[model samples]
Target: MHTGLHFISGLPRSGSALLAALLRQNPDVHAGITSPIGSLISMLLREMSQGNESAIFIDDTQRKAILRGVFDGYYGAISQTQTVFDTNRLWCAKLNVVAALFPNAKVVCCVRHLPWVLDSIERLTQQNRWELSKIFNFDPGGTVYSRVEGLVSSSGLVGFAYNALKQAMHSEESDRLLLVSYETLTREPQRALDAIYDFTGLPPFQHDFESVTLDANEFDARLGTPGLHKVGNAVRPNERQSILPPDLWRRFEVDSFWSEPAWNLRGVRIV
Candidate 1:
């Protein structure tokens, strides 16, 4: 069987982890959190392997180090499984790079409402030690800066990331890609899981769907509040309660260039 790679990407606080956790329930799938740095390294390595002079050169150990560096202390240690699922929120725009490396890789882009995404990001910034500004490289003035600045200033980077992913889905290879909304997943997890299983060709596992909800509170608590040790350090609650006031939400506009009507299409509901 060919080993498959599934990229579970989305805006921060958009339930990438939740989706990963649900997919991890399948015995045939090894889904875990990864980072953009890993995607970059993989792309570079792939390019070099293809005899592309524009790519950088590094020894085997050095190459492994680069990959490992992106995942904190767990570099190059990813188990060789039949199917590896990388659930990284930062892999939103970077998917293009990853696609170049693994042309056959399957992508699952998760999305959430723009207003809620911004609200969640704002809350996370105030409550957690993590800095969204630094992560997204936001700036008030600068060409590249404006791209993400608009998101941070209004709906937050989550919206920007969602838009980027949508654009990526338009590629000729998009049929191999799956776009999953966070709301749909939450409302009907089993149905979502079933779709995922079909997409990845994984045999069903005899696990309770409710088991995926094990850390519901701990996960919710991290949004805007302090992190709980039990649920792992990664999860956080929304700090701002709401990202947009009623007036702001009304005034906030979705750029025509960034809208994806395909996302509005109703698909299978996994309720």
Candidate 2:
């Protein structure tokens, strides 16, 4: 067996938690709101393979076992029988590591346009205007320009995942990657789920759209974001207009790089 493991990753605020909540409705699948495993994986990758001279002593076998162990260690609480879906915004960047550890694993990536991704975060920050979300801690005093720049920088939230997803789209293991666009997920969820189920060879389960929910209050509050991972019991389109300044939103209006016809040849099956 291939460990019955998979991942949910891509842009934040792009319905990753909602997807997890819907999938968790499946009795045989164990899905959770965003997990820290991706951060842990990144830490291990740097420590074991990139940092100090001692990393030279860590061969591929040992590195693989250690990296793979992070999943076993964090998910040790779940019964081995349940199919697992780990969520992280960074997993798209680490497909190479995942391929090494779990060859059969697939990553269900949720992506949104860059302008909307920025708009979504801005809306949340404005909602909690009195407080600061830790997400912007690196640049607490940044204005809309700085914030957008930071977020779209090479290592920023959207840029890193965008580059990584593009890389994974072209990698030899491309077959194991599935892209679920935020628009498609919201407007046509059944089609999105169907594509996901078919991609991973998981028997399709009817997810109750109206009854889906995932409570992440404690975690969200700790990060000073009260509704960061909140999902409605029912999945619906977000008709809310961007609360960001019109100029800011307009500046990033052309953020949907994946929509280009040239990208169609990359072999990424976007739903």
Candidate 3:
């Protein structure tokens, strides 16, 4: 029973994927692209809730067991020898469940400036000119403005993740959360990794930032977005001019709440 578990979550287009790739270098750790366990847990919860006619037969204790078993069954074999770090944007929204199930688990959130996050996604969409992105429901028509609007809508990817992070920041479990800014992760990867190790209560291990590698071609292809999870051979800042219109870029300038110290009421650790 490998009880050592943690989570990797935060906004997309951040460095979650890259962090996972770098963490893979550690022989004692296990991490990868987002997994289906988050969705699976939701489905299981619904099935065991009052929505199900058979819910009367399942008790609270059994419910907890089933939920915990999902983690055990999914990663038990590999986690027996290595610490597990599950990746999912939904984890931030489910901190209450996390507390009940994995009380000691820490959540490492990869964050970035809101404008840059949107810019990265927009660049990916443009790169795949011939295909429709599942991010926008695979619709064939929409301008950059429209796409941006849709992505920041209440239920949109960026919007939802951003909102969930805010919710996590104010939760009682906020102390269990660690925010790793994309800039630091890229420009000062060693320091970022050191903070992460300290947060997760693990010993440090050497990581080859210069040779970090990841392949998500098949996954990105299915989503009609190429190189979405691609990582460079070296972990260094890739500064570039923003392709977004001036007005659009400026609109989200104030959205990176994590950058503002005043917004961190809970004093959640930020790297």
Would you list the C-alpha lDDT of every candidate in the order shown?
0.54, 0.81, 0.93
Ranking by lDDT: 3, 2, 1
Report the candidate with higher TM-score, 1 versus 3: 3
lDDT of 3 by residue, 180-238 (tens): 99999999999999999999989998899889988888998998888889999999897
Per-model clash counts, in order, read 13, 0, 0
What residue pairs are clashing in model 2? none
* Model 2 agreement with the true structure over 119-236: per-residue lDDT tens digits: 8887787687777877777345777777778777888777787787777777777777888988998888899999999988899887777787899999988888789998987888
Better TM-score candidate (2, 3):
3
Estimate the overall C-alpha local distance difference test score of candidate 2. Answer: 0.81
Model 2 bad stretches (over 4 Å): 77-79, 138-140
> Candidate 3, which segments miss by more than 4 Å at Cα?
none
**How many Å off is the CA of 27 in candidate 2?**
1.0
Total clashes, candidate 1? 13
The C-alpha RMSD of each candidate to the native structure, in angstroms, is: 7.5, 2.0, 0.9
Q: On a 0 to 1 TM-score scale, where does candidate 2 land against the true structure?
A: 0.92
